[model samples]
Target: MQCVNYLFLVLILTPILSTFSAKILGLFLYPSRQHALLGTALFAELSAKGHEVTMISTFEQPMVQKKFRHVLVDGTQIRQKYSPSLMSLNVSMWEHIVFSNSEMKYMIAELLEDSSLREFLDAGEKYDVVVSELFAEALLGISHRVNATTVSFNPTGGSYELDYLSGNSHPYSYVPNAFTAYSDEMTFWQRFANTYVNLFCAFSKHFFNLPMQRSLLKYYFPDAPPLEDLMNSVELHLVNSYYLFETPRPYLPNVVQIGGFHLQKPELLTVELLKQLDELKNGIILFTVGSHRKLSDFPVQIVETLFASFSKSSHNVLVQYEGPPPSNLPANVRLMPWLPQRAVLSHPNTKLFITPGGRSSVVEAIYFAVPMVGLHAPGDDDSQLSMMANRGFGVCFRLDEELREEQLSGAIRNVVADPVYKRAIMLESELFKRQEMSPLDKAVYWVEHVAKHKGAKRVKSQPAAAMPLYKYVLLDVVVASAALLVMFAFISLWLCKQTYRVLIRRRQTEPVKHKIV
Candidate 1:
């Protein structure tokens, strides 16, 4: 009877005790609200799953919950200091890269100088895992300081930098680099350009970006491990990429795609907004230049052109513009400082989405099965919108001074009139939805998996990451093969020359045989 009771108790406790709670620290200090949203959603889910999550970010959480702590940083000051002209699209890709590196350096210096963060660091707190965005690698030193497993996060689709950190293969022939506006199927010149851009970016990151970050890391965390070791110690990479929409690329075991993890169940729109949307006879068109940018950043002429185009459209327009409303604002166009983007997109009467091709906006549009007219702003938006255009789901155009009313209005009119664009996006939405596990669930599982095991050392590709550059590129093999071919060619030529010489010598040695010819 005693043995039986003990066995029953053990079985009961097995299921209950199997649940493990971990102390997690999330460092998402990037200034972008969209980036914060991704980090918040992830940490929120972890907190709900019984983990103690403390997040340091630039944005505030919508809802506060137990087991979750929020530490807010003043990202606006950093942005103003480093990137005064945040939304200028006139710069080239190289210029943008240089500017971003400088901004990240300034951001790191500011983050390290925070008094609260310094106190937290000195508190001797230990965490099982530290999740951080890959934008600022110096922040990964916090994980080392706290004695936590490092998990790097990418808010956009995976880049070559992430691939290198996670030891994932990046085939440049098919996989477009981060900056290019090209698809998988590329012409020779496109492939060449992709390879060139990838190399250039890699060179810049290593020689320019990493050194500055290392200097900052050394200055801030004198006793912490080196930045390279810290980066190599990152056991898992979680990317906001789904293969259905993003081009299919090879991923390593430690690299997980948790795209659309930020998406939540659509919330009910305000009653007044709902009534207005329902009253529109023709469908509605939603236009927003994403969260990070405002309409004021756009050229005055371009804004005027957009207004003119919106006025001519038959459908009602909802514009998320932060600038002052124009005196000539049309009756059909409504300008609000902010809009409930997800709710508006999920509405049945929403016909089209006109955006500046931010990743979050594009993903949301795809989720809601709304066709888009992409006025691509600078940065990766050009490539993102170009991919959408190539896939036949949207039409992409440069958001610049040259944009005219006809071009803007015509693209919107065509996408709205044609059912093909809608059908394409709907198919994409279905494919994106057809996943065995939700992206958020997968992300949480992996975070827990790392915490449960203490680290993901067993799953990491050690050999691939440790391999030398020449070996990784197979240059040695190519050189050896070329040498062997050259040797064989030389031997063949020597044999032929000897044979010809022998024939000539034999004829010279033979008696009087030339007259027969």
Candidate 2:
């Protein structure tokens, strides 16, 4: 009822509030396909709202509108510089962050030096707003270049770093980092590890990342403001996360939660695929590891175990296998190079989804009200899957576990046979769908508001991004308080000792008088 009233108010005011369309620049340099889709959605909505949009992205769309221009920036060149073979399942969190930072530094440098991008910068193209993805420090330069009101597009929702920068309360006492497999209710060791990792990354960014980003920004645009100034000047943030799937925490007014902004009504599945699903009365189970990790990368023994389990299962299995599938597969098992993932999940015959627990996948599955069996790997996958399990919508198994046929098959069987997973997911889906305004609507509204208002600085926390670590975390205040307490303690102890000595001296002086009497 409250949501209905809020949305009704928005609908009534939308026409009155919206007055003008302005020039917008959308810059997305991330190479991942998922991120590319998100970037596309943002620009598409802006174009739909009659704004003049210029987009620089890896997955470029030919301009559908006369006012929109698309520029293709080849991300593959940067990707090729670092071989994909360098990444493996065994990589640690610290190593991953360091390696990722190195790659981003080079990528940003390459992007800035690109002849076309350099020309764009020199062309003096003025934009009213600049919307750039928040992952890379290099992308922040675009906002500075255009002198536009900057809005950060974070595919992953607000993190501690962003929250800290924006002066939001992101307490290390409770909240866990994305890299660690810990929840808000963490064990002592988990909390210690989480704090250690956050502090380590924060320090590393200060000493290592900031200097490199600063140097690169200066090299590209010498007259631009300092890198920290550019970041702090951001007027708004569009984060791709929902509150239900996340730990409940406070966010800044400028930070908007726009998770599921890209989701659309499901597209129809192919006739052949639909037929395959129809034949299975027991229902279908979908398996995918997302875009980055191919099924071929798995060990032969692991594949054999999965195949055996699928062969024995009563359910029909649809696996997104990029390579040649097993030669002799079970009659019920099917493989495809690609499947419209959300569409397939929406099918009535679909029973369970088996995934590596990527954020987009988990959110989509929840959107469709499907139970999941997650294979937890290192990095964000572990943390996300653990969260899903804790929420009771799914169960998670560590990929590092020793494999057995029954373990895989039994888990699937339990998910299919159990009613709890189904009930929980359905309820969650209901809550997820009962939003006041669609994520896309909220995003479009906020974006246009910024363009019309010339920025959202009034709503943003003041100057927190440029604040030093000691001040931001109150380390200085803590040290000062400790020092004061120590001084007071020392003074009190000295007074007591002086009194004790005087009393002894008085008694000694009185002893001569008493003897005379």
Candidate 3:
């Protein structure tokens, strides 16, 4: 009987295992360049692991033509009648964080409402698993409709609610007043903030999904966790930050961390670029605001201040300027419209890196062991690194007017001279290394797991919350009833006590009255 039971179990599990080992399709949906790169990288890596993968993106980059199937989701093509300018995209992005909040929800709704985007998805492609950023939450209904498992991939150190989905404790709670920005670590306050943001996020989702405003919230989530974890609509979550970069916390079994997912084949520099870098023997000081922002776009005063600071520096300066060098370019400075960053960072003569804290740039610096004089590129670029600076990972420069040339010079000197910063970074590098699994392998493993077992079905696609704030919190009944009970109990207790006091006083009053008479 036992043998028969075991045989039946094996029979059931075999078909599931077989399904997970076959071909799969992945949905990589961010329209932004940085996020597009991440999605493309995952698609390539997953395809290499022996699955048929199709990619969808917003732009025309080299990755689209690669070995895997590609779907070019030209939002411009979608908005054929209404091409949103790049600047408009930025403005909308800004409003998203402050106003819309759950960018994923807003984007998903936008995509859904657009007939072009839906037509793109309806092209009759079957997917086994869906890997997307948390911001991609607005489209869970589609994923559900198609029967796919979803995975949330994060490259940045995430807030606590995100950490909860990743199966570990946030690191901040482990150490107090230590690292800044994001620790993948949660402080007590950080956890509180996560809760607050989640509550706000659910409402934000409501706003984004106003088309479904009335009945959606009521029917959606019957067993949802707090609002903070609202859009964690994935079967599994993979965070790009490692235990080394972030603090560990308790997460569900499905959450995972595969740091250094952005890593890839090294860039080979042009001979001209290499020669230029080598000639800067007094050592090189490089400045870049990252690909998203052009250096010449810096405020005139800030550009003047940087030029003034370079005049006093002992090292030769290399700044990636879009236009000609600033008129004030000192004799020691060399302006190149474009510099291969990997080559510059790897150069023997390069001593200090001066730039915004792009994750790629940060990793490149770490890889090359080059110290940085970071002037955080304003907005989301700096938003992630503001905490990295606080954690003592790098020297953060305020781009404010008060930051003069002398301060820049001093900060450069401090970053270059300080050995501890290097030590801390080296230690971080080692931790990053230890957490390093070939992300390609992990991604493949999961893809295959889904295909073999038809494992994707286990994941549900709707919001976890079954009811709205008014119903879930039970505020209407709980608050009113509790308030009334408290008032009634207080009044009854006060009346009884007063009556007892009066009787006792009356019993003792006869002696006092006789004396007084």
lDDT of candidate model 2 versus the reference = 0.79
lDDT of each residue in 230-266, candidate 3, tens digit only: 3443566666655444344444445555555656545
Ranking by TM-score: 1, 2, 3
Task: Report RMSD (Å) for each prediction in the order shown.
Answer: 3.8, 5.9, 7.9
RMSD in Å for model 1: 3.8
> Compared with the true structure, what per-residue lDDT tens digits does model 1 show for residues 441-510?
9999999999989878877888676666689889999999999999999999999999999999999998
- lDDT, model 1: 0.84
lDDT of 3: 0.59
Of the candidates numbered 2 and 3, which has the greater lDDT value? 2
Q: What lDDT does the true structure give each of the candidates?
A: 0.84, 0.79, 0.59
Ranking by lDDT: 1, 2, 3
Count of residue pairs whose backbone atoms collide, per candidate = 0, 0, 35
Candidate 3 worst ten-residue window by lDDT? 80-89
lDDT of 3 at 343: 71
- Which residue window of length 10 is worst by lDDT in model 2? 79-88
